[model samples]
Target chain A: MKHACKRVSQLTSDSFERELSLTEKMQLKLHFAMCSLCRNYHQRLATMAGIFEQMREHDLNQDIQLPIEDKQRIQSVLEKEK
Target chain B: MVDKQMNPKLWLKEHGDYLFRYALSRLHDTELASDMVQETLLAAWRGHERFKGDSTLRTWLVGIMKHKIIDHIRKEIRHRDISDRLEHDPTSTYFSENGSWQDSPSAWRDNPEALWDNQEFRQVLQECLSHLPEKQRNVFEMRELTGDDSETICNAYDITPTHLHVLMHRARLALQTCLHKHWFGGHTKS
Candidate 1:
């Protein structure tokens, strides 16, 4: 049961990056059926991804600005091109 | 004719900060993110004629910046020791020789959507993220936060899909463990 949880958790993360094979998907479905611990593990990962998306959205809503010196440095480089 | 609508000076004054913020969010380095913003403008300036107008100028600029961010990560990872992590599960420490979680995960206090509006939770989330090792953090950022494809990450880091999966798995494990301890707090170990 413990080892199955480990495999399921790993497969859960892999599902984030790619499509899991049919066999792998079945394994997760079956494991998750009987395993609440792995279900909690999956929920935590999904929540982490959600938090990042929200964090990015919040950052977008803010009035974040670039610093003056960096702007000046970039302008000079543009000036040199002229 | 080269588009006169695209002006480097104006873009610098207007779109610079948005571009910088976009880069900073992904790169997490003020200097480098700022540098990428400048590089995006210069590249846009040089290649202004190449842009066929299917997208807004800001969108076009962001498209360029995305590539810049990914390429920067690729360069960084290529030079570093991706091999050091080699199929070695960092979470093994969290598990016994048996695969049960030493610290089994529990439900977080709030739902994800509600947690978004909570400033304190966001602060703790950022702190947990900041605590990650650089490579795992980068892998997580590129794959999760930046929405880069798995293939791009796998190809750039010279690792297989499984290795990339392992890297992200390790990151999620660490981040979840961290969030539980810091955000939940009853079980936090010093």
Candidate 2:
């Protein structure tokens, strides 16, 4: 609802990716104390990141096949490198 | 990097196919993915002494291939147009006002469980990936799926770091909106 609150909400996403500046962490904590919208926004960002992480883990475990020619090509390349 | 004592020929014989498949999933191009995989092994051979085996050799090989894919994308960017716009305006009946997993995007998001359970998620994923423009898909698969750094991705896609950010932002926005429609649009859990 306030200018500080909006900036604080933005910090939630930024913070999830990396460490927040001391000022950012303080500003967000202050805003989260008073702003429900920013709190919900922060929750949503965390939820989305969590869901995406699960999707990635799902992808890594999926079985797949590589074509024969591509396999041979990689072998040749590695052999040349050796 | 493969060890010096490890014969390049023997190393290739042992791991080439696995590496090729790994690269193929990310690049989705047979010829190019192969070339990149080859380059990765070559780079590994040249840089073998640097490999302290902190992880498995397979992990090391994958790290090299990932860089190679980025390098390939950066080279390809010169031949194409680049845009950071989201494609959310595609007519869809299954989305809410905010494009949640509600009203209008329902058609696309519906029945994800069936797809997931049947291993058809892979098929649906491939279809969705095919719908993306090549560069956008590459950026999505590399950054979002493969855990590549933005700077390395920027180098791979031949984009300024700023453009790379915009492209990635647009990609996730588009995918979230699209997937909401097809994967979760209207199913109230029973």
Off by over 4 Å in 1: B78-84, B155-158, B185-190
| CA error at residue B70 for candidate 2, angstroms | 2.4
Q: Candidate 1 lDDT, tens digit per residue, B1-190? A: 2366577988899899889877886777889989999899999889888888877889999988877876887788767754545646577787768787777677665677787887777788778878887777777777666667777667656678777777788888888888787776553423
DockQ by candidate, in order: 0.64, 0.21
Ten consecutive residues with minimal summed lDDT in candidate 1 chain A?
A: A54-63
Recovered share of real interface contacts in candidate 1: 0.71
Instruction: Please report the candidate that would top DockQ against the real structure.
Output: 1
Candidate lDDT (C-alpha), each: 0.78, 0.59
Q: How far does residue A27 in candidate 2 sit from its true spot (Å)?
A: 3.4
lDDT of 2 by residue, B61-152 (tens): 77777777766665556556554444443312323344332222112323333444444444545566567766677776776566667777
